[model samples]
Target: MKAKPSLRPEDAGDRPPFGRSWGVLYVGVLLNLALLVVLFSLFSKAFR
Candidate 1:
């Protein structure tokens, strides 16, 4: 079997697939959760 090439952080090939920072993705997830929580609270209040 052939050996696979190792990826290094300093190498140009080692980059985010979305071409964006991981922090941006994490922030998006957090904002989405916040929006969902707010919507659910509104929905629960409407039913009560």
Candidate 2:
């Protein structure tokens, strides 16, 4: 039987496939909150 090569920490590249960034995520969350607020306001106004 052949033995598999051992993996090392350095074998991985510096950057991950998905990567990581906070700026875009923050903007997306803020936009979602704004849309939710607008929707809720419209519904409340319509029912009242």
The all-Cα superposition gives candidate 2 an RMSD in Å to the true structure of: 7.5
Alpha carbon lDDT at 29, candidate 2: 83
lDDT of 2 by residue, 4-47 (tens): 89766655453333425456666778999999999999999999
Best candidate according to TM-score? 1
- Candidate 1's TM-score reads 0.62
Candidate 1 Cα outliers beyond 4 Å, as residue runs = 1-5, 8-15
Q: Model 1, range 1-48, lDDT digits (tens) per residue?
A: 999797676665544577377678888889999999999999999999
Per-candidate TM-score against the hidden true structure: 0.62, 0.56
**Candidate topping lDDT:** 1
Runs of candidate 2 exceeding 4 Å displacement? 1-20
Per model, state how many residue pairs clash.
0, 0
